[model samples]
Target chain A: MISKINLAFSQCKKENRPALLTYTVAGDNTKKKSLEILNAIAPYVDILEIGIPHNTPVADGGQIQTSAYRAIKNGIKVKDIFKIVKQFKKNNLNKPVILMGYYNTIFQLGERSFLKHCKRSDVDGLIVVDLPWPENKNFANKCKKQSINFIQLLSPTTSDIRMKNIIKDSHDMVYYISMLSTTGGRLKVSAKEILKNYNKIKKINPKQNVVIGFGITEKTISSLTKADGLVVGSALCKTISGALSRGTNPVRTAENMVKKLRSKII
Target chain B: MLKLKKGVLLIDQHDKNYMYGGKFGGNFIPETLKKPIEDLTNLFGRLRYDKNFIKERDYYFKNYVGAPTPFIKLENLTKHLGGAQVYAKVVSKANGGAHKIYNAVVHALICKRAGKKYIVGDTGAGYAGKMLSMAAKKFGLKCKIFMGAKDIKRQKPNCDAMRKNGAEIVPVYSGSQTLVDAVSECMRYWVSNCDTTHMAVGSTVGPNIFIKICAWSTAQISRELIVQLKEEFGGVPKKLKLINCVGGGSSAAGFWNEFIDYNKSQVELIGVEAGGPKNSKLHAAPLTFGSKIGILHGAAQYVIQDKDGQIGETSSISAGLDYPGISPLHCFLKDTKRARYTSASDEEALQAYKLVSKLEDLSPSLEPSHAFAEAIKIAPKLSKDTIICVNSCGDAKKDRAIITKRLGFFR
Candidate 1:
């Protein structure tokens, strides 16, 4: 069976532009508001990257960290994330939904139980930021057996040998961390350097669906149109944070921001 | 070969090819930190066994930090307890008033040799911070420490000691406002400033490479103990019991490292954890009660977390013992039954604190007071001929203010 993640990538290929992947904390501020925000922004983006709002997100920068803190303070639990995904899938949305966060959250719920929850909730993929290659092979295989995509992350620091090993078992897509920094840090490296590394991975597995994330704001999205998808996480979360601080409607604000970012891709 | 069981990677304990047997240690850091951690690991491996590095460390240990701290028998306390013969490894006699100076001195030397301009660390009780500050000053390097706001308030003397030694203290206000938060903040700081700063992790609780490096540096405790036992008892005891209180478990790891290869049935290793106050949500004994294996501070270990996997808030009168996680090495030992894990209540530790101060005329820090409390309980239960060595790793003079406040002396 073709997973919704693969289908989404294939649809993006037909549109002749990089897919727009937007990430938001699964219960940021409030569970109700988080669901509303996800529904509002889903149509404007190709894939919905829902964060599980863990207490420690080591790979994320300040913006995502603050968002996760807010979400956790608002009493977001793991079951609530499954509930939100089930609600989103009940709406018959075609956009693939990926649950992204650290490994401890899923490890707390046994891997098998977590995968069963994902299958029940219709979660298309998982992006456990801390579960790097080789160490993650067994869990990745379990994810594959359940027909859920276990996305692999590639950074500039990933050596050639490690890259070959990681790509060998990587399924659905590969997440290329754009720079040697966290998710929201400044994009200091030029576009040429990013493409240089991106093309290197492509040479290794040209057919693998590769997406670029980190430091991709609306303005920077236009510069990174050469990949299969562009993940805008901290930018969108920062927008929600700013809207909440100003007492504005975060759902409307994030929807407008995603629409504008999507407009920049083409 | 590694096996994944219940989301935990299990490795063979006898695997000498891997450091610490990948079962206990794994690098779960961010991508940006991989290279820096690797660099630190490689530098540690090179410097750890080098002749010049050994000479320099020995010179500093003897002249600067005062190595081979006295291992004296607490004759009065043992007589009063009326049971097993008790001894104390007095690490407080070492420089900076604790055994943590050994690691600080070694890590600072490593950073200085690596050409790093700044050293960063996180501390719970502030002893590590003060020691690192002294090491940084001796090595002529800039130093910064992340301390929890609560710990900064509780450990004011050590905080002042760090500042007096020319180290900047960054108060962390995240995640229960404690040691775990301080560690998280310090790691974020290292991630951003890794080019110029080396993270001198305060304990053997972080990534795999860090644990190995710290274990190497701290092996001095056991190494000295081996010689001291030989001089006093003519040889290592056949029925020996080593006890130490564990927070991040560096002292316990150091004290037990050499003895792990010994016959397990002959030597008994006991690790005491903070049991907090009875009938209160203030305990930090993860190994004693916590069953789930989870990742915290980069390494997979037994973590005291809530049902939803949220890191639990830990509490102890002793700031050093108030942590949500213990070192992964402690977890492995506890899992294999190589060591017995137990807890001492806050009230029990306080009683032991006073008893040791009065009987032995030695004011022990609350961190080691937990170990004393356990010793008081178990020493009486053991045979009179049995030998139990309690690692009195900290001096209670540093906790005078907090102790006075808790005892209501001001009022």
Candidate 2:
């Protein structure tokens, strides 16, 4: 059976447009506000990637890091993240929810137990930022045991040989880092250059659903529509932070921002 | 050189294969970092076995680093302690005034060989930054040193030396504003410039390749010590105690590398960690306190974290040893019962610093003072025939401000 995540991507592929993936820190501001925000933006979002806020996120840029900090300060726990995903799934079953985070959190919670929580909470997929391929083989197999998609990652720095190995080992989806940067960095390379790299990765395993992430904003989203999917994390997070500071409701602000991002790709 | 048990865990193993113990280390890194790290792993694997590399490295060790630093029996310290005969490897006399220079010089050599023109490093107490700056200048490579903003305020002397060596200082103002933040920021910066810059990781932490590189680099300390040991005892001593302070565990890893294979009856290793200030719950003693296994940077090892797995901020009187995580190799040793680890409080470390200064006329940084304190405690238990050698890995001048603030005017 095709996973819900694969079905979402297939639907987008059939529609001749890139799937719109949005990332937000779970329990940002407050649990109620975070759930409301997820529901508010669920219409435009194809797959929801919720960050399990980490205090020391080496890969996150400043914008997403701020979102995570707020969530952590508001007393977000691993169980709280599952609650948010569960609440969102209760209302919207078709949209896939993927937890993107560092590996320490899951290791702290027993890996098997955490997957049990994922299954119970209806979490469709997982993207452990630090658990790359080969090292992830055991965990990925464990993830597969529960019928969850364990997202693999590729980068511009990844060699052709290693890319093929990674693609072969990957589940249904692969997260292609469009450039050599953390979450919120500006476009150091052109959008055209990003797609060229994206196309090269696509050629390796054309059947695999590859998504482009990092440096993806409204302006760059349309240019990257050639890919299967695009991930907008920092941009939406920046909106949440920017809105809260300006005394605006973050849920409404994020809904509008994600909707605008969705308008571009479709 | 003492032959190591190659391929037992990561000892003598430098191929793309990584780890200290079988389960303690692996390259769990982003895809962007994978290629550069693998390239580094391959480069080190080939270069470590090449005799030419060793010759060129030692050429600098002799001329540039002023190595073969004095290993002397501390008669005054021995008399003051009144039990075991105490000895010390005087690393403060080495260039850049610390054992950190050993890894710094080797990393500079690596950066040059990789065809990279620039090198970047993260520093806590400024010793790593200063040492790498000095080596980068000698190798004619551009250098950038990431330091915590708070460290810049306290460790002025070493920071000044880093600047004088023509390296750019990137002040990190992130969480905890210390070594941990500096390292994270340094890694973030490397993600952008990895094509041209080789990150000279300051300690035996981070990814598996870095742990291996740092272990290989700092192994020079033991390389020289073994020859000195033969000269001191006319052969290697069986009843010897090897002690050093373990922050990120580079110096201790080097000091104990050749001795790991030795039976506990022959060479017993003790590692000292920062116990923080008295009456304060904070500390840098992950291995001493039984921290759980978690991934920090790239390697899965023992780390101090909250109930939610967030890396906790650690406090130490000495900036050098102020870290919440320990080397994977140290964690392995601790679990295997091959080595013992203990903590020295800030008060005890300060007292040890003053005692060593007064008795031996040698001042040590608070980082090594922790080791000295541990040695002082264990010496009374051991007999006079036993030998206890401490790796006095750094100087005290950079710690003058903290020393003066805590202890008042010293006679």
lDDT agreement with native, every candidate: 0.86, 0.88
Cα lDDT tens digits for candidate 1, B1-411: 332233222222323323244555587777667678778878877886699999999899889889898898999889989899999999888988888998899999998889998999999999989999999999998999999998998899999999999999999877677889888888878876787788988998887777776767777888899899999999988789999999999888888877876666678999999999877976999998865778887878888886778888788988988988988778878777778999998889888887788789577899999999999998887888789999999988778887776664311
| Winning candidate number (DockQ) | 2
Q: Model 1 shows how many backbone clashes? A: 0
Q: What is the lDDT of residue B282 in candidate 2?
A: 95
lDDT of 1: 0.86
The Cα RMSD across the true interface for model 1 is 2.3
lDDT of 1 at B232: 92
Model 1 regions more than 4 Å off:
B1-23, B408-411
Q: After the best TM-score superposition of candidate 1, give how far the Cα of residue B269 lies from its true spot, in angstroms.
A: 1.5
DockQ of 2: 0.75
- For B1-411, candidate 2 gives per-residue lDDT tens digits of 112243363344423336554657777677789889889978998998889998999999999888798898889889878899999988888998898898998999888889999999999999999999999999898999999999999899999999999999999877788998898888888887789899988999998878888988788888889999999899888699999999999999998887787788889999999999899989999988888888888887899998779999899999999988888888878877788999999999999988888888688888999999998898978899999999999999999888999998442
Candidate 2, residues A15-85, lDDT tens digits: the string is: 99999999999988788898999999999999999999998788888898788889888899999999989
Error of 1 at A265 (Å): 2.4
| Fraction of the reference Cα-Cα interface contacts (below 8 Å) that each candidate reproduces | 0.36, 0.72
